[model samples]
Target chain A: MTAMQEGAHVPSVEESDEPKMRDVFSDVPTDTGLATDPAGVVIAELGDADPRILTLSADVGVTLAEFRSRHPERYIEMGIAETNSISVAAGLAASGFVPYVFSMSAFGVLKTAEQLRTGAAYNRLPVRLVGRLTGLAMGFFGTSHHAVEDVAVARAITGLSVVAPADAQSVISLMRATVDREGPVYIRIAEDAQPVYAEPPTYRPGELLRVREGADVTLVGHGMGVGLALRAAARLAEEGVQAEVLDAAWLKPFDAEGVVASARSTGAILTIEDHDVVGGLASMVAEAVGRAGVAAALGSIALPDERLEVGVPAQLYERYGLTVPNVAAQAKALLGR
Target chain B: MRVDTAPPATTPAPSDGDDGGPTLDRGRSITPVELARRADWIRLQTIELIDRAGLGHYSSTFSSAEVFATLYYRTLRLRPSDPAWPDRDRFLLGKGHAATGLWPVLADLGFFPTEWLDTFGTAGTALNDHPDMLRAPGIDFSSGSLGQNLSVGTGIALAGRLQERDYRTFVLTGDGELQEGQVWEAVMAASHYRLGNLVAVVDANGFSGSGPTSDAMGIEPLAARFESFGWAVREIDGHDPEALLSAFDTLPDPSAEQPVCVIARTRKGKGVRMMEEAPQAWHLGHLGPDLRRQVVEEISGRMP
Candidate 1:
């Protein structure tokens, strides 16, 4: 943890002779398949489309700078108070304005679960909670900045729609599609997600997007997991083993039917996610499979339920078996091939 | 059986001052005497409702009866027949356990059928231990968890400001609830946003569920705290209708830059002799038929 702060004075990667903790993932792809800074640009467009749309930032005003400049009155800077932001958003929703609360996933979901549950979900308000830089994307900022438990916590909240968008296009499409959604929506976005969609595809909250079709095994993922699943499918294709990929973006009103269908068709399901293994996409898939009585080999590539190691996201992903090779091998092992 | 120990609230002063501040609920015909009597009526009705419910925060409701009455009967701008009037002022109960105090007022105002109060806390009743805005028409926001309503109220005020409406938002919070860290978050945000349409009335009854708020957690110099946070501060007798009316009269204009906080000093279980004497014990308790009859008679005697 101190390693990041120790080299804070090293201004640029080019200037520093030695690779820093942040430079560990220098080769990681930055393209979101869509040419846009989703956080800075999409929300502003949404505000422009609707007069009642208000965007609130909790110490992350930079993400909403465009919206603030365009619709100055609709943008609110709520400092570092995530709990207050949720309740305030609920109030704004109650008063007929759709408020989008933007914050780090670490604070947005985990720190304000009660407020989100009692204030927004209980009241059934249209408060859109946007959690940016979810999972280990915060990297060297350490575990406090990571949000591995966000999905588990958010999915348990009754009326909240827990959504994990794989890339910038998904975030934009989902935001536009669900702006008029009746109740609260939790939008989880990873800062470093690879491009998975060629364009803004049709998005429904509880429906799964079949990114790639195969037969040997089913590779299910959400958020950063989708990219890993895609990469794993490509690697498996090289080995003459075809793996199907499903993007489980909506976790709350989970795609149970799709999970059951995939389980029955493929007979092998491997869930890969950038979250703790206990109560995330894997747990939801497991429940769906068990309830359907499907005879399938189930496996998961996820963060272990323990204190996570502090490093760049790529390093942690590799250490935790969340890479393409590990996922591909896991799928192959599940298929007995 | 006139068993009186504590003195009754002081007689309300004559209402004659006019500093030209914005008057809340102007043109209303209800007098201060009628409003003060309404507070007692709320207390009696709350006791009956709580007794029906089998479990409730008696003293918590008692302490805020006058605050509720003062707001509903004299302060708030409301359309009883039209609870969803977009222009009507909004009130949120941060200390939601004391919701019984405000339930009768909303019912009498015709926000919902009075019969709903009869089945309170039952299986199908919309009236529960806390106020639910979805179930009950008059509630501005649902609040059982303390310390969150202030932020909600701030949001409502922000909405009003954004929509270019003059509706004010009042949040009734418990002093004990101020101990929760979220309250300060709202306190800071409300002032930072310059929500002049927001007013947080602290029911400073000095008793929480455990014991004295000071012993439980010292939140003294509350006025100074709000002042430091850039809020326009006012301290007044919560039980006195005149003082309450004056406080609301002198509140910062809805267009002003600073939010307002009225620290209304009060006693838990006010108007009930036994409850007031030992507020901690009466924070929550059951009364038998005889004791209930006696308490009812004693409270009703103070009406006229």
Candidate 2:
């Protein structure tokens, strides 16, 4: 197989070694307020609000229904128009109301980019943009719905922070943080209900959570890839290879200090994300490391530049080398095991 | 303090100054002739900037010069030094081609250094052919693509209403620009939301890129169209500064009923004699050396 070159280091798949087992999940607190892990906690927390949060959705209106049943006056169904919804949310924000504008990732960020740039960023309005079905999460919907480019676009706009939460727990925490943060924010949520990975000490914006700390290799991931990285780190640990797992929940205002500390602690770092390798977390981490003068060898496991072919989420993920097995194999190769 | 309301004035003749120049403000009671002269000076400065830059939508810029002058100098409650001052009336130039007019107005209002006008069309200059809010100091929204300004204006107007601020938003759209579907969407949305704080001005200059608007896309009976869209419509001669001022002064109260639309009928190139009735080609085409000298002579003769 042709070896992929990632900044001076080439890790051949054939010359890879297995990693050791370390069950970090046991250390993770089960009491985290997550929809999947502890639905009761999330439901209870949401129930005790002064003024219920308003949730707006684009055409699909799936989340709109759920938010409306709980907070009817708060839910706004803006039909198929995403641009108008963003503007309306800006207006709502001006009225001292917190509004969560939900839409498909592609249309949500790209279509209403000008509104976000002017109404939210320039005006310094506090509005949370929830882009559902992000990063190839809409596997069957093809390229139109896939929001792989949202992170880069959101990051480019000044005063707008971008976050991608790994699982349900991280989503709830990030959503809470977004409301508290006094500016515009873009949050990418996957369509599929992925397994919860973030522990009790909930994910915070601009903070990198280390799931499992190791000395040999580091597995850096954000959003959906965090779950995959944790699973791969566990598999690597079982085979005697020590691999560190880091969840990069915050994409913009990236935690360079955390990344550099982790990279210098370990000699090698592997960044993984569900987005395209070009402008997403991989490029961001590399740029951060380069600017910080960190000399760790970095490799990225992300979607290739080519247009993705249509297939089932699992099939396409495996084909694109984003699975736990693939990440572990790449990590082992990086260590020259 | 009961105020006595007077009847509207008749259509007065285009002014000839008592000192033997084009009358600046003839028969206008509210805005004085001195203010009109300042507006004219601003307009002249605008023409000079466009001519010096060797590029701009000069024809369109000239068409809206009087309106811009009237708004900045006489009407709009704005602080040029602090463009982002809360509770200030918002003015969105929908036809961004009129950046030539806007740049001069903003300079006159001391939004930025007046010397910046000389750098127009040069590389790395903030004064581009289009108005970019990031680049220019006083620009509220970056607008070059036609129909987007009204929507943005609607957002600003909605912001004012939602915040319970008395500030009003005024958006100027070229007659030709009404061809875009988004403008109608904004109109519908503004009316639907009962945004009385919004005033949409249609510069019915009867010209677009190709030729006359009727020959191009036909946006006539424009006042009625706005009225049908649930707006309180007013029609006036756009070139008349006093008439423009009157239309703006009597803005419909948002609490009363609907939004307002001021349909100002104007010539494509109003001030310069040669280009006043010029074809659409003259919109961006520069005046020759001889024509430029002639325009300068004509403008100088019209001054007091």
Candidate 3:
């Protein structure tokens, strides 16, 4: 955490010329696949679109620098308390202002879960929670910084809309799409994510995008996992396996229709995400596919529910089998290859 | 008695002073005698409402009875007939368990029908132990949890400033509620934004849900604590309507851009002598019929 805060100069506690912690992942160029900072840019643009929209940063206004600079009056720096920030955002929402509370996923969903439930979700206020650097995207920041069950925590709340934009485009698109809703919305602003769409695709909630089409198996990915799923699909294509990829953008009002359709068409489903294997995209997809009465052989790939070894995201991806080759192999296994 | 749905007749507005500060609705039209009488009535109503529930926060409600009476009758600039009146001053209950005391005041002011009070803490009742803004129209904000409403109040106060609404937002919290870390978060924010329109009143009843607030998690040096947060702090006797009224009036001017916090010393189960000093969180539960009658008699006999 101190290392992340200090940014450039962080002294090593362990004595080594080649430090295992930093040196191993330093040259890997920590690829979070984010083309542009999402909330930092999109929310400011939304301010231009709707004057009633306000950006609230809970000690992380630095992430929302663009919005703060452009609309200084509308941006509220709420300090370190996420719970109070949510309620403040709720009050602002109830008073007819759309408050986009940009916070860390570690604090936003988990720390403020109760406040989010009572103030935003229960009241159904349009308090947009931008959970930046979700999951292991922050890399080596360890368990406290990692938000594994943000989806599970957020989506459990009745009215909260959980979204994970695959890349910069979807963050922009989803922001544009759900900005007008008079209910709570939680978006995981991830980094190290690659663009799945060629250009900014039109985002309609509950509609899943078919990033790739095939007849063999359906590769389900969400947020940063979309990149992993696409990589796996490409790997499968090289091995003569025609794998179709689907992006579950909106998690609460999940694209159940598209998931079931893909399951029925492909007859095999391999779901993956940069989250735990429980209560996230994998759980959501399994429920959708099962309730739809589809007999797709389902296999889910996700981080295990335990304290993960601290490493760069790329190393963690390989160790946790969250890479393209691993996902491709999972697809083959789902097909009984 | 049926609740009056009509707005109360406007009183002679408070005379301007040298300070030229904005005036709060302090017992306007209603005389001081009537204000004290109504505060007694609110205590009576809280007893009845909690009695009906079979289990409720009697001590908590009693603690804030006068604060409720003073604010609704005199301090808050409200339009109970139009609960959503845009410019009406807002009253938020951070100590939500004590909402029973506020229920009647809202009803009597025409925020809702008095009949709604009959359904408190019952199935299909809009009035729960904690009020909900969605269910009850006059509730400026809903609260079930502690430390939350003050933050919401901070937002409403910020709204008043941003929109130049001239309306004030008041949050009434229990002393125990200060134990919640979120409350301090809001206190800092209120000061940062210089939300002069926000007035926070703490009902320092000394007890929380489980025990004495000091015993539970001591946040002593309470006034200095708020002062450290950059709010203008005032210590008052919460049980006295006149004191409460004067405290409301002396709050920081909106032009000053500083929020105010009133630390009103109060007692849990205040009017009911037996429950007043009952040790440890005598904070909840209903008195059985026989004891309930005795408590009511004791409270009424003491009223002026």
Candidate 4:
């Protein structure tokens, strides 16, 4: 299998050779043994399987080049027009074609929000919006490229399904699951590839995937934060602290019951995500926990609601307390340990 | 505030008053004379609908009546019985505040019961100032935000090309809405993709909400701009049914390599003397019963 040649490198958190979570993060692996362009491969496979599947790109050609070659007739290049591309996808969906529009997360979700809102979601069309380079993955590209607030924007649009897939396997699983889902779907993906899931797992929107189980505290994460949570859980285990891990792959239709159940079991919950401190996983958890009136102590480890500096992703992650050690420390703090 | 379910006080098919002959119906083809009569009726009903609804964009709707009438009556190939027919030509209105004008046309087409037109802007009504495809049938796509419907129409045209279907997609945009940057993006994409199946008609009414579109943001030399982006361009009198008919009739085949754009120069308020004389003032307003009566008389007087 070919490895991803371009984009940011996402190291695997499931590495068995590392003893400490800090060491695993510092010793970032150059390869994760995952397929090259996992999202593109899934799209190409879908095009092969279904004739109605059509793909559109807004000058983000690297990830979808394979799909373009495989389904030349099915691909459309909109050339740096993210706003127009979204409405085009809606029009295509309105005419019995399933359109998957690809663009950078910031532009695709924020820049074209009105088109996504009135054109796709309000029309209740099945236009798949694949927003790549999520979060601060475009580390040195400054704030214009980072998409930390896409979840908030997408979630606010009624009838839009918001999803974040952590790794290659989850990308395949989630893409296939939501292919025919009613209404428009916004899929958030980062520029890294790691094996977060040991195998392809079944996906249902609004449900949390339990990655690990513990009794002391729950570490709920989505997107790349899922892998970070797993590493933090492993680090807590070394200290004889049991940390339950949940992968919040779906943000919209969030599993309130599962969240309440986890809080009931663990008594403490720390929501982690590569998004802002508000209006994301933490906010969603807070709403659910608040509505359920669950007495579990709740905390969140997320990016500050301020301007982020330009640097490599790892340095930025460390600066924002997004490393495994910080996550574990936050979880322990929630547990008052 | 009234949920008026009464059929709109407008004829489904306006009759030629002298002979009492049906001038225009749901047929896919109509004479230029019939087209002119239907366009006048669209203006008359739009004034009535907005007059009842208390507020609406009268000038924009007035400017687009002839284009809407021309497309629905003579240009588009649609199965009114099956509004969702895959092969039907798609029409999206970018200047969607003018939707009151389209509501009456869709009702006349039998896409929905004519009674639905009376419920415009009322509580729980499907019709709004902006078009919503989910609430109403015969609307190809919902559009309220300016500069979006062209992209939607481009998308439909692209899909038709990929599916090997020969259906065309028409998008009517206001000249004021051309100030939006996304419209240029759609213009570029339509040409770059060589979407012959796509047709965009710009209602060059010269006036927007604030004032003349030139003062708001100059999108003048509109034909040259479209041609620079590789579209086959033509400019005509938007209010003239014969000009509108010729523009639609002369459109290139869907298999052609270039997309077509008809830059329709039109008056903001084409029929009513008060509105035509002062378009900016009438961009959006409530026509009280007295002015509403005068507007109906003006429209009826101009009918062929």
* Fnat: each model in turn: 0.96, 0.12, 0.68, 0.98
Positional deviation of residue B111's Cα in model 4 after best superposition, in angstroms? 0.9
Candidate closer to the true structure by TM-score (higher is better), 3 or 4: 4
Evaluate all candidate structures by whole-model CA lDDT and list the values in order.
0.83, 0.71, 0.78, 0.82
Tell me the TM-score of candidate 2's A chain: 0.85
lDDT of 1 at A149: 95
- DockQ in order: 0.80, 0.15, 0.65, 0.82
Per-residue lDDT value at B264 in model 4: 94
| TM-score top scorer | 1
Candidate rank order under lDDT: 1, 4, 3, 2
What lDDT does candidate 3 reach at residue A62?
66
Q: Per-residue lDDT of B14-37 in model 2, one digit per residue for the tens? A: 344333332223123335454455
Ranking by TM-score: 1, 4, 3, 2
Instruction: Name the candidate that leads on lDDT.
Output: 1
- For each candidate, give its TM-score against the true structure: 0.92, 0.75, 0.90, 0.90
Residues B64-182, model 4: lDDT tens digits:
88898888877777666667777778888888899999898887767889888768879989888998888888888888899888988998898888888988888999898898998
Model 3 lDDT per residue over A1-337, tens place: 0001112233344635422334211122223343337657778888988988898888886667778889998988887888888989988887778988988887789998898889888888899999887777665777777778898888788888988998877777888889877689999876667767655678677778888899999998888778788888888889999999888887878888889998999999888787877798888888988898878788888777777756666656666777677788778987988
The worst-scoring run of ten residues by lDDT in candidate 3 chain A lies at A1-10
Ranking 3 against 4 by DockQ, winner: 4
What's model 3's lDDT at A146?
A: 75
